[model samples]
Target: MGTINDGNTHPGATLPWGMASALPHTKDFREKANGPAYYNFGDEKIYGFGNVNLSGLGCPVAGAVPLKLSTGKFDWDIENFASTYKDEEAYAGYYKVTLEKHQLVAEMTATTRSTIYNFTPQNDDKQPINLFLDLGANTSHRKGGSLKVVSPQLITGSQLDGAFCGFQKSTNIYFALEINQPNPQVKIYENQKVTDKREVKGDKAGVVWTLDQLDQGKLEVRVGISFVSEKNALDNLRKEQGDLSFEGIHQKAIAEWNKQLQKVDIETSSNDDEQIFYTALYHSLLLPHVISDVNGEYYSREIDKVLVADDYTRYSTYSLWDTYRTLHPLLALLYPKEQRDMVVTMLEMYKEWGWLPKWELFGYDTFVMVGDPAVPVISDTYLKGITDFDTELAIEAMLATAANTKKNPTRPGISQYIEHGYIPIDDRGGDPQKFSWTNGIVWGPVSTTLEYNLADYNIAQLANVLGKNELAKEYYRRSDSYKKLYDPKTTFFRPKLKNGNWMESFNPTDRFFDIRWEGSGGKGFVEGNAWQYNFFVPHAMNDLKSLMGEEVFLSKLNDLFSNGEYDLTNEPDITYPYLFNYVKGHEKKTQQLVREKGDLHFTNTPSGIPGNDDAGTLSAWLVFSQLGFFPDAPGIPTYQLTTPKFEKATIHLDDYVYNGQTIEIIKTGENDRYFNQFTIDGKVREEVYQLSHQELVSTNELVFNTVSERLSEVKE
Candidate 1:
């Protein structure tokens, strides 16, 4: 599922929340550089093994310090160094490939701090084996770097990479490589020139390790990466991989993955469906990685200093705008302690950087997406009883970010959003050539307004739970700002000028950047058209339905699927399939739509995923959908029920928070397309389509019975 065209997820080896990831590299294909380090189905020759990668991002980053192994004389031609492999395999915590050209088999696995590679020669060739450390190579734009041969068995270096989607500060990665054998000859080079000195620093600096003979059975290399310092990198290597055999590390990684995957146990008849479920679960838990070292020390790009985390494990790579919809809620159900730590980490980031992260990467705030997404993520976590952090402080941060109009990059148009109740399209002069509605600069005015309104609604929910009723009332009123953009004449949330006039000549079908003419199409939304964005009011579905009228809303909603206006590849329209639950007796359509979409988009092949994992948002949606229910609203504890894919499923809740109870969902009846009835702890539930999180975790069993008819007929 990770190798889809838009998924961009590499087949890599890493522990859950590991700082470093190891994946195969196909460097000859520069046009596909925006993709992952490895595309499982592509035929590009293997260039090297990339030690660090950002999974599922549209633009690649942090594929630094590629290590290539060969058994021939030194040649500077990178093209000649690559080898073709036939047999290849990858899973949650392991990857293996055969280098047919080199007659070698390579396998890789990782711990929290380091990745270990094992290479076995197929033939007994007397030629000397060489390991090349290409410091200049990276998936993103390289600024500069340095490499030094500290010892015969050790090489240390740092690389500076920048320009993630043309935005971000240069990230410095310090690395330490340790060879298993002692006294291997090392040579340093700079700008393609062999240097006699042990140190080399420049744009094209690299190092080569030459083993005298290849008669040995296998060779192992351990690499440790750190954002703080070289010494810390070495310490990390010793702590994670010191004297550990390659098999031992591989087993450890597998055990770790099994621990996370076993949270949800299912009884399924189809092996393909089983693989899909486990893979989706695997992808859902790979992000928001722990960035702190074993000693709780990390380098903060926001603060420009090394900081110590004494209480909690600091985490990075928060794709909050994509994750808050489903991923955070899933975490609260299965991994409450980790979710609490993540919330604490976000609070700490707010304390250090003055604002919560939007799209944080490698300790840098990229500000990649719109909205105050941290509000929804933290609010969801807090409302789900994962409140191990300071609630008052979190509320203060949310209020400050929500109310700020200037000097806050996270909330771009907060002042106008607060004052005018909507962000005007004409505020930045409606010029598509001079501006973008998707990037980080004055983009998606209407979309941002909607996102801000939803975020405010989430904050209000959290505030109400925290006993701040007055503050909650204020935020709740502000959340109704989405209504200002609704143009009753167009029957859509049309973009308006600063003078309170609708942008003329609008088309709901035109996507972002689809129309070139001035104000002809989507000038206010991000990545989607009006039809997709219209159904985005997850927090206030009843209100939206009322505004559009039930018949009009139902007609338009049905048209979204039949007319091919619905987009399943992005996050903005993911909630559309679940919206039918709000209208009574319409859930059968939801079930059919969800099942059909899931079958189309998800599979067991390399290109199984429908689109970008969006740092696991899409995967989480599938996981929750297959479970027969979904947390459609972020800050709300309720989950709207549907039809389960499996006949029976069990979700193991975090015992620390949920009193060691497990929610067992049993599907009874031959029909799996419609839900006829539901029961909790054997008590029949009539006319109720929602289950609270409290009720879910505390209950021993929740059963859904299916019938051959539609829900409306059953209700009648």
Candidate 2:
């Protein structure tokens, strides 16, 4: 659990979808192998403040352009530059830290495009105040950067860096920094040595400004960042923060967070539970960031050029492999307008790049994880009634990727899968030995096959809705390819060679990273063992249960947990616990598993999350689980019911989807975790295990009665 509970998340300050995040960085801990913005609760040194970050990614990227303040003689050594800090605090939109060594208190808040820093130096040191612009300290390996002192109070720069997930590419970030007071002297440095130039351009370039006076010992700085250019960065700064006070900007950010957080409110007896729920919600909205500038200008890696948005705000950083499971569905439920715009952004990306994004970061296709995930995301959004995007173009994009055979970068190994029912492990001629490009050769064939089949199922649903009968039939046939790998002898999804025979060697428990993809491997699965991948067929679970037989399926499901085969840390097996809802007389087991796992995995501490939130995928899972139901299938509009964790919970659905309707769920029991039955609008439901999306939103209230034991039947 310790390995999975690393909680590779930063306790930072940022808006709900803000591009800029402010994090407290520890200089000494920088050598450790932590994620992008590492802030452990045990570390004490405050090296500097990071201005940009990407949350939950195992590889280091983003977190570019750090800023540190010092009084007296400037020291470039890492050991001398850090200050021991205490009294650290962080909330949804704000972070505060006290640098005890320097007697300085640093507080930060953020807007969508810019960040505000308020620093107050307590000691009356006669030494001059110096500010260091660390251009080289990016999370990604820095290639080169340039810093130019625009004026006594302003500086502008850009850093070129990349290698996200070890994919060799270049990403650049242009930034503008503004100080409230003017400074007389500014010096430039390259590679840690001071230079006499006003501007420097090269690797590890930085600038330092010596403040004439601290203006009553208070220094305020505002930073704006842009993917396009420095001009846009300054434009964003002026438009968002403008001459506003630090308190004003902080208050506005808080108000925005409150507005979004109020969408779902719960009544709980413990403060820890409330914090865990709201904080999980806060983490869930951090990414799929707002990439477009204030003037609707953005950098498009798909075209390798600059582009402009007409009416919608463009977004980037789609961790689709992890997010398509839970985060996007959660968005469709709570933030329908935003989800529609996100789908529009995906369609536009296809128009610009030739294919949809797999694991995108900073406008580049990272190819980080497996699967054709965008299929389920768009299909789920359309089925949920957020159909404001171009449906025809979206369908074309889905088909283009689905039928691709020439080693397309987006849908790797589609050609092989089309020829044979499953992706053969021996079809590894074009597999990438290095993670440099997105040429789309199948790396993990077994996992890719299962994921593509699931995606095909979702695409078939969309095709059926659009009246494309032949296309729907073809995709529906392809969606059943998962059965080809099923071996009744073992009742598991086994890997096969191209010669229509199972691999000679077999070990369902073996797991490792024999390939570039993360997680266990060796038996043809990606990041999971055969035991976990056995239940990958979420679209046709009933058929799977029939194939495995009800008694065997139930026993295996229970053994998965008791024998420690169930992995809650990863996404592939997160839904395994909920499959019991599909079996009659076993729904109570679903409630028991959901409640037990929720308590064991999530907490209120900094290291609370079970795994890399994976761009809020795990957090969204917790959110949905706590809400008393889960969107068990991505493209389906139904939710599998479970027992609520709270006494009362309310969800304020987006007006665009449900006419601003609010669904309140009330649970009545005395410490009882089993579900007895449920009623909607005073009418009892025949099937208490599931609820359709229409039924959930159209009604006003839902009441769940509980007892010490599970009820055999519903009573009117």
The count of backbone overlaps in candidate 1 is 0
lDDT of each: 0.81, 0.82
The residue-level lDDT of candidate 2 at 616 comes to: 86
**What are the clashing pairs of model 2?**
512-520, 512-521, 519-527
Q: lDDT: which candidate is best? A: 2
Best by TM-score: 2
Question: What's the TM-score of each model vs. the native?
Answer: 0.96, 0.96
TM-score of 1: 0.96
In candidate 1, how many Å is residue 91 off? 2.7
Per-residue lDDT of 545 in model 1: 93
lDDT of 1 by residue, 1-716 (tens): 76756687778899887888888886632223444435556756788887877677666677876888777787767765699887888878899999887787999999988899988888777667888887767777654578777788888888877666557477788899988776677778888788898888886778988876632467788999888888888888889887778889889999999988999999999999999998888888888887888778998898899999998888888988899998889888988888888888888888888888888888888787688899998898888877778998899889778987667688776767877898887774335464432232546778888899889998899899988999999999999888889977777887888888899878787665532334333767777879889878788889999998887777778889989988787888897887877777677778878999999989988788988888888888999999988998888888988889999999887677887788898999768777778999999987557888888888989898887644335211
lDDT by residue (tens digit), candidate 2, 1-716: 11135666777889987888888776432333245545556676877887777677667776667787777777766655578888887877899988887678999999998898988877676567777887766666655688777887898888776877768777789899988775546778887788877788876678877775777568888999899999999999999987788999999998999999899999988999998898888878987999999999999975789999889988888999899999999999988887887888888888988888888888878777788999899999988888888989998888778887775877777778989988988884464565334665566677889999999999989989989999889988998988899898887888889999998677887786456655546468877888888888988889889888988788888888888989887888889878888888888888888988999888776668887788888889989999888888888888999889889999998789679998999998654587767999889899998998878888889888886544533211
lDDT measured at residue 269 in model 1 versus the true structure, 0 to 100: 90
